[model samples]
Target: MTDKIYNVLFLCTGNSARSIIAEALLNRAGKGRFRAYSAGSQPKGEVHPYTLDLLRSLNYDISDARSKSWVEFSADGAPQMDFVFTVCDSAAAESCPIWPGHPITAHWGVPDPAAAEGSESEKRLAFADAHRMLGNRVNAFVSLPLASLDRLTTEGRVREIGRSLSEAG
Candidate 1:
């Protein structure tokens, strides 16, 4: 296998919750095999508090997490992404900037936990649920035989991972 480390970007409307969670999960899960980044079309300008808490509770390092714009990754000198995923419905439906490398893109839409109503406990549960869903998808993705698969097959498998949750129920 080639010692190529893949770069993955997770996109969402706000970059505060879902995408942030995905980034953390993939980075840790992929180990040194992938570098994960998260950004938004319209960044909230800060990481969501509950997101930080969720990640911290799970023992993920939150030091590098921040809400950033997709424009940052599109610029020259930014790491070229091998894969790009949209984790929110709004971001998936919007027009995205043309990525330099033409990375394989997929939609892994999950409900906005930050949009969850009710008490703090309920909102926290929403974040946890989002975390769980994203975790399942990311786990499936990392389990793929990436090095052995052709580009077309790899793309299909990644997209399939996003669909597994809905298809499961």
Candidate 2:
């Protein structure tokens, strides 16, 4: 497994917002050591407009992002996940696919900023806050000492990272 990059999937009830944000943040931060992807158990088929707006403001490519099902990853020849995280409180409780690799999993449990019912400005703020929190956790994850620990990826260290990342979020 030399030079293998970790594949991380972010899951949510709706792939429109939180999962999208986590995907972009982790991919951007990981560069080469991590590969970030996202999907939902129940996809909305379209990303929330605000998700695109905020990501574009950050100079991220939102054009190719769309809501998709977790089943897409359950197929043959699917990219084996090294880690999986549920980014929304709803998804954390929902039934999930049996990821093939048995990759380390965790729950970040970010509230649905999309469900925030209020002024447009308030909704925007909620999205931004979720973005900030997820970004912080991803930063912590990428900086972990994965290279030094012996048989680290196979050990319980992965679970620790997941738990630590979640609590910090």
Candidate 3:
């Protein structure tokens, strides 16, 4: 296996829940092989409480999980991403910055847990569900034979993963 580490960025409108969840999931699940980061088109300036709670309960480090703009990734000297996935419908629909390396992009849109209306328990459940969906997608991503597949094949596979799993809910 090649020693190259893939860099991934997850995008969302808020960067509070779904995108943060995906970042944490991939960083943990795809450790050594992949590094994950998250950003928003319109940042909320802080991660959602439910998102922090869910990730903390799962033992993920939340020290660096602040909500920030995608512009940060597009700026000079920023890490070049190999993949970018939009985890919310709004973010997917909006115009995004031209990434430095022209990363393979896909929409893995999921319901916004922050927008979940109900009791506290119900809100928490929404975050948990987002985590579960993102976890499955990230796992499938890390399992891909990236070094063997051509760019076209890899892009198609990534798109398929988003379509199949994001549509699950």
Clashing pairs in 3: none
| lDDT of candidate 2 over 33-129, digit per residue (tens) | 8988899999999999999999999998776699999999888998999889888878889888888978778777777889998999999999998
Q: Model 3 over residues 48-73: C-alpha lDDT tens digits? A: 99999999999999999899999999
Per-residue C-alpha lDDT of model 1 across residues 98-144, encoded as one tens digit per residue:
99889999999999999999999999999999999999998888888
Give me the displacement of residue 67 in model 2, in angstroms: 0.2
What's each prediction's clash count?
0, 0, 0
RMSD of each: 1.1, 2.2, 1.0
TM-scores for all candidates: the values are: 0.97, 0.89, 0.97
Best-first order by lDDT: 1, 3, 2
Better of 1 and 2 by lDDT: 1
**Candidate 3 to truth, TM:** 0.97
lDDT of 1: 0.94
Instruction: Write down the RMSD of candidate 1 (Cα, Å).
Output: 1.1
Per-model C-alpha lDDT, please? 0.94, 0.85, 0.92
> Which pairs clash inside model 2?
none
